[model samples]
Target: MKPAPFNYFAPESLKEAITLLERNHGTSKIIAGGQSLLPLMNMRLATPETLIDLRNIDGMKQIREVNGFLEIGAMVTHQRIMTSTLVQEKCPLLAEAAGHIAHRQVRNRGTIGGSVAHADPAAEFPTVVTALDADIKIEGPGGEHWLKPAEFFLGFMMTTLQPTDILTALRVPVSPPRCGWSVQELARKENFFAIAGAVCLLQLSQNRVVDVHLGIMGCSPAPLKPLQAEETIRGQELTDDLLAKVADLISEQVEPESDLHGTKAYRRAMAGVVTKRALKEAHHRASEGRQ
Candidate 1:
């Protein structure tokens, strides 16, 4: 099905885009890459009267190192991120996650900002960003504001962004030395949404865990931070006993819902299994310093 009739505007600048959004008020939606929005539009789930295309905006597609973070423009394609040497060196977790986002065609057209703005509960980028403590930048008539990943996602398919706000970019801090990271998901086929997924980031000092961040998706309304579980690992040796305890803590924290993918019991059980496996693999990688 085709999308319903709507007035399309390709703004040349961010200011013009914000002005157009303000002029349209509640009747507009921003289109970047259209990888997710177009499908919703075709299904008649979203029928905005005005569509603001942001493709022509300059300076919104850059990927560079700014300060201590890797700043990625909202329009940077997934494929570009997957192949970028800088991203691979600085944030290999993001590159690995981007490589698994759908097929080549979809990745070539999908933008990181678009995915984050959509705030799909099952998407890899959102979970990874949340685990890494990334921040998102937004611009509107009110000027710019930054939101941490935890606060950025309010609920499934919803965010703190106003209708008039356009996500400008995402800022992710560079991983520290000996930082362990891993992402694991269970899908019937490659690139499909996971039945259960986990992303783990572990900071180690002298073979002991200094900090732990674990983010889970596809099992909750938004990415689950599982802070209680993280606290169980912090300042610990991450020995076999501690790992088991950490996994048990994570299982208790998650209240997964039953759906077409699996039962609540299955999801809850797998969440623990996946978390344990991901943490172990990440710890091994960090110890070996493997690419």
Candidate 2:
């Protein structure tokens, strides 16, 4: 199927894009990579009257360090992130997650902001960002605003962004010393949507967990940080017994729905299993670095 008729605008600058969005308001949609939007549009599920393409907008494709965070422009492609030396050295978790997104063709065309804006529940970037407590930078006619990861995602396929706002960048905190990370999911193919997934981060001190952040995907309306599960591992020595307890806590916190990929019970069971494995792997990585 072909997309519905729409007026296209390719702005040369960020200000012009904002102006176009402000003028069109509800009638317009921002097109970054169109990896997700085009599919929806082709199906007539999203029929915006206008498309404000950001491809020509300069400065939105940059990736650099600002203060203590790694700032990634909204238009930066998943392929860039997957291969970035800066990203790999600073936030290996994000790089790892990016490597797992779809296939090389999709990653080459999919932008970070596009995926976040699309807000797929099982996407890798969103889950990683939420677990890392990253911040989203958005621009509009009034100027810019920042939103915490927790506040950025409003619902499934929804966000806190206003109609006129454009996501400009994402700010992820640089990995601290002794930080460890892991991402695990089940898919029929190498790049298919996860049946159940877990992204875990642990900050350790003298073999004990100092900080814990665990986010789950493929089991909720939005990528979620299970606070109860995180609390279960905080300050504890990561051991087989402790990991088992934390896994049980995670299982109790999430109620996954039955779907075509797997039964609800199966998904729930996998969630616990994967969470434990992710934590264990991350802990081992941290231990190896320390040694």
Candidate 3:
């Protein structure tokens, strides 16, 4: 299948891009890497009267530090993040998770903002950003606005972005001292979508849990942060039994859907298992920080 006839525009500047979007309004769609939208368009699942390509916009492709946070351009590809020296040094968790994306072929062309905008429940970048407590920057006729990951990702393949809005960048807080991060996912095969994935960030103080972020994927409509699990482990020394309890708690709370990849029961159980594994690994890394 091929996409329906549509006018295409490669705008050189963001101001021009948003102007085109506003003029096209309900009949337009934004294209970043075209990794996701192109396929959908080919399938006729998404047919827009106009397609606005953002790749030509100059400032949306760089990664730099600003005001104590790493500001990643929306057009930054997965492979770029995977290899970026700054990303590796400041947010290695994101760097590691980027390697788990579909494949080198896709990573070479898939933009971080595009993936987050695509918002597949099992996607690595969205879950990583959520765990990192990142902020999304968007621009439109109304000028600029920032959204939390929770606020930005409203549902699977859905976001709060208006038709005229462009996702410009992501701002991730630099990982703190003594912070350990890990990604544990259950996938049918390497680079396949995760059946269930857990991204954990653990910060320890004197052998007690100072803070923990548990970002879950493939078990709910949107990426999740299991507050119960975080609350249960905070300010306490991690024990095997306690980890088990936290895992069980997450299993009971996640809402997995029945699907062809696996049964809801299977995904639900795997979600818990990955959560425990991720937390355990994070703890190990944090301990190594002491050495």
- In order, candidate lDDTs are 0.88, 0.88, 0.90
**Candidate 1 structure quality by residue, lDDT tens digits, 1-291:** 999999999989999999999999989999998999999999999999999998999998999998989999999999999999999888888998898788999999999999999999889888888888898999999899999987888878888899899999999888876777888888889889888889887778788888877888888788888888888788888788987887777777777789888999898888888888889988888788665
Per-structure clash totals for the candidates: 0, 0, 0
Provide the global lDDT of candidate 2 against the true structure.
0.88
Could you give candidate 3's per-residue lDDT for residues 148-174 as a string of tens digits?
A: 998888888888889889999999888
Per-candidate TM-scores read: 0.96, 0.96, 0.97
Error of 3 at 166 (Å): 0.7
**TM-score result, candidate 3:** 0.97
RMSD of 1: 1.2
- Candidates in descending TM-score order: 3, 1, 2
Cα deviation of 12 in candidate 2 (Å)? 1.0
Q: Give the TM-score of candidate 1.
A: 0.96
